[model samples]
Target chain A: MNSVAQTFSTAALQRNPAWAQLLGLCPLLAVSSTLINAIGLALASTFVVIGSNVCISALRRIIPDAARLPCFVLIIATFTTMTTLVLEAFAYTLYIKIALFVQIIVTNCMILGRAEVFASKQNITATFFDALGTACGFTLALVSLGVVREILAYGTLLAGAHTLFGPTANNWTIQLMDQGLLPLAAYAPGAFLVAGLLFACVRTLRSFKKIPPPKSQSLIQD
Target chain B: MADLALLLIGALLVNNFVLAQFLGLCPFMGITKGYDTALATGIATTFVLSFSALCAHLLYHGILAPLGLEYLRIILFIVVIAGVVQLVKYYLQATSPVLHQLLGIYLPLITSNCAVLGVALLAINANLNTLETLIFSLGASGGFTGVMVLFGAIREVIDHDDVPAAFRGTPLALVTAGLMSLAFMGFQGLAG
Candidate 1:
């Protein structure tokens, strides 16, 4: 388990491209209510999935296979328009509340499903540790669903960390509850009821562990 | 007519495209479990999201806003919504060979559905004109095929109500699409 701590524990815990391959759940439930807009669109989709998985694994040999999925979607739409012009020049009000989910992160099928399953065909340092373990498992499911929907809708937790840290991180707001919060965990049906109770609390903590399940998974953690 | 009935009741119930702009939730919770393949994957994602919003409003105002190439309009609206989902899967495999065999491979994954590139980048960022971008892409694909056939007929009656063992399947289909997005937030202000 060495490949750089198996690329940060296979991106913040075994293959969690947003809780185990539910790939970018629409910008992980739209700008995750806030925890500085889910760590500024999870650090601009972990810098466009590790700069389009090391430039599609150093242009995986003259990219032919019938123009490889439109050249890995034009190198993940030119790093999602260079991460939406560097989040509209340094987090301009959390880039206007996540500029259309940062230009729909060029249709985030988890950055073209890690540029068609592990950067075209791995190399450039195992396609930069499978794009830094699938962008640290999609920034640990957008910072743990933006810290449980900003601590159940604005009870507060890094309430607006100086809109992505600037102006001396303006008193980094963490005022956890002065009242019984739960304003539907801040709308859109409380980000689908806190992403279905955070995938039923990671399928009841991976059913108390005794491992083994794997194989073509998806009961989404069940 | 009252601004196309307030842009077709603001895209069939105030800004809906899958419960208030979460835009095409990976084919609204993966081809909404059953109900005739969720009404044939919501009528093949309402004909590739209103024909990629009338060809991304005539190729972003008659060719990428007069060749400024508006930052190559998200790589030319994902190569013309993957060539209009391969011309609606060879025009539904030559005129409905049983809905091209019940939309296999969810009709070319509706060209990577971010709700068909969020209704062609919200009809070219709502500058909209050509008949209000084809009535806001036929009212956002008739409100995404009326909430994917009302969340596929309430996920076929919650797949015979049982649901335990760590809230079976995608946590009971994302808590029944968060109670049908809180009954579509009571159609908020019913289009003002």
Candidate 2:
């Protein structure tokens, strides 16, 4: 039991997919243009990343060295196709906006990177935990950015929640601007600027914690 | 002639491959520190992008889309782009190792560059015929090249110029890109 917890924490502490590693920024920023779009993307990517990790890890040994890239391509394509079909059948409206971006999840650096880096190297159980850790990290970032963009751009949070969460979520909207803040920062430029600023903040905080290495022993040696 | 001009302006300024569309950000930020390097990279990208567009279009229209092979695009494109990069690598090694190294990484990276994939996808999405797809890709690649070189030059100056502490490097480049996107917005009035 302790080992299982240890494994999960190791992924949490040591293998954060979004912040510490900076993987998967494409869909992270692209679909983040709206709250519903962001939620839809987060759910889709989480599904792909977790599913692919498990499948790929299961077949890790069987995959040939010479044909690995193509093999990975084939695997990711199947998963993407499955997700696209599922979304099309049930969530047609949200799926339309996401369009190619959902299929493009196969090309996402973080998802592919994790499959290649961690999942291939670890057992299936550990791989699943690692993928979950990363997906949760990514979902956190996407939700935070979505909240900011939705509030600013539409003067409400979860402005189109019904699109993803269904008709019941029609009441999900939170009016952040009943008083006056229309034309919120939901445009393409705003997304880029916000993402850029977020990246800078993280970089700054990282450098602040960075300890300067001790003086070289060569200089100290007689 | 008017269409060409529209293509040029739209690609070079408006709808920049890097900033506006969010395509090709990997190399845009990675290789734009120096104008000289950026120019070389831009030239190489322009060549590959133009040809990739041409080839990918042919495969899409003449072959894939008709035969119910549209699902095969992502794989087919990677295959063609990788093949082109390999052929270019062979030519460069025999002739100019310096040029090969100059574009060594970005050339291969172009295979998976979302911009390339986005271009092929756009060509199909725009539903252009054979010739139209060719023309569009040429324009798109040209625009990609133009903006790449221009952004590269602007970044060079920014690197030397006094920049704010908070917005020193990537932050400053992105802010510059945002301003440039606004500049490009001025040209959106042109006919496609």
Across A1-222, the per-residue lDDT of candidate 2 in tens digits comes to 677676665544345455445455556667787778988988888898889888889999998866666576567767776887789788999998886677667666677667776777789988888888777878877887787767767777777788888999999888868742435256556666776676566557656867232222111010
Scored by lDDT, the top model is 1
Error (Å) of candidate 1 at residue B128 is: 7.7
Model 2 spans with C-alpha error above 4 angstroms: A1-18, A179-184, A204-222, B1-8, B94-96, B157-168
Candidate 1: residue B78 Cα off by (Å)? 9.2
DockQ of each candidate, alpha-carbon based: 0.25, 0.33
B-chain TM-score of model 2: 0.85
Candidate 1: residue pairs that collide: none
| Model 1 CA deviation exceeding 4 Å by range | A20-23, A27-51, A56-74, A78-123, A132-198, A201-203, A206-222, B10-15, B24-59, B64-73, B76-117, B121-131, B134-177, B180-182, B185-192
Global lDDT of each model?
0.79, 0.70
Q: Pick the candidate with the highest TM-score.
A: 2
lDDT of 2 at A153: 71
